[model samples]
Target: MTNSAKPRARAADKRRRLATEAARVLHEQGVERTTLADIARAADVPVGNVYYYFKTKDELVLAALSEHSAHLDELTGRLDQLPDPHDRLKALIEAWISQRETAARYGCPTGTLAVELDKRADGILDTEAGTAIRRLLQWAEEQFRALGLPDPDDLALTLVSGYQGMSLLTNALRDPDIMTRQGAHLLRWLDSLKDTDPAA
Candidate 1:
């Protein structure tokens, strides 16, 4: 590649790395507590150089949100690879439950961010924060619909709500086992719904 194009590519790579680190920091320490310096430090980028990519912390937060949204889409695509809808939903639960330790320490990344952003005076970031949860909910709804459920939307909401609620409690109580138990319960619930026919 030309030298000019090389610099642009390197800059883009730095921005992507910074966005990833920002997402991790934001998940661990709410957006209010996360600073541009923290992200720069985590990403190993020069603090001053962060301004070249993001003028404000909010802009970085938006980039982090976009990064998370892309991750959610990728996860949905992975789950879709399972042939059985029930298996796909259970895999989703397992995927989140596997992060029980993190959830116990900092709470569900997406859920915590949504709650924090919703409380902020800035409405735009709050809406963007909700994108992750919305995507999961939409994916869950599609899985439920594929299972022949009549009220797939309600089931989807319930699944998402249950997962988020358990994560919240686990974090507040600092108990990773709470998520483990909840994951088992969710799997059982999926089993109960497996044979239900939408036509009936």
Candidate 2:
């Protein structure tokens, strides 16, 4: 390839790596607590180099939020591959529960980020940070729709809210079992919904 193309490719790779590392740092530490230095250290770059990629911490966080969105898409895309709608829904719960330990340690990645960003004084970051949660809820709604559930909208809220509530408790209580237990109940609730669905 041309020298100019090589430099551009390397720059893009470095930016992506920084954003990914920033997302992880933000997840492990809250947005308020994470610093550009923390992200740079995690990405193994000089702290000054962070400004070359992101002029402000807010810009870096926006990149991190974008990175988080990509990750959620990758995860939910896999869940959508399951043939059965109910199975797909169940798989979503299983995936969250699989991260119970991490959630217990650092709170749900999306949930915590949503909560923190919602507190911004200007409010735009709130909407940006909510993207991951919205993606999850919308995807769940689609799965319920495929199940022929009449209340896909309400059911989607119920499903996501339950997980969010359980995430809070799991973190507050510092018990991963809270998520596991709630996930079981959620799974059974999904099964019972099959009974209510005439299509089932």
Candidate 3:
């Protein structure tokens, strides 16, 4: 590669790494507590270099949000591979349950971030952070609609809310096992909805 191309590529790599570390720090510490220096330290990039990619902390936060959105899109793509909508929904629940230990320690990253950002009076991070949850709800709603549910919207809301509620409880109780138990209950609930519609 040419010298100019090499530096540009390295800069891109550094920015990507910074965004990833910023997302992790934001999830663990919340936006108010996370600083660009923290992300720089986490990414092992010089603190000054961060300015080359992001002019302010908020920009870094947005970058992290973008990274998170891409992650959700990737997850949705993977879930779409399952032909059965029910199985797809179950896979989503199982995926969340599998992260029980992390949720118990740090809460649900997307949920917690959304709540935290929403609580901000300035509304700066509101739209971007909110998109994370909104995207999940939309994906769940699509699955429910595909299942031929009469009220797919409501079912989608319930599924997302239920998962968020369980995550909140798991974090509050400091018990990862709570997620496992709740996951089983959710699965049973999903099964109960099966065959509710003859046309489905």
| Highest TM-score scorer | 2
Who is ahead in TM-score, 1 or 2? 2
In model 1, state the lDDT of residue 66.
Answer: 90
lDDT of each: 0.90, 0.91, 0.90
Predicted candidate 1 versus true structure: per-residue lDDT over 127-186, tens digit per residue:
988888888888999988987897899999999999998999999999999999998899
- Candidate 3 structure quality by residue, lDDT tens digits, 90-115: 99999989999999998988888888
TM-scores of the candidates in the order shown: 0.96, 0.97, 0.96
lDDT of 1 at 142: 92
Q: How much lDDT does candidate 1 score? A: 0.90
Candidates ranked by lDDT:
2, 1, 3
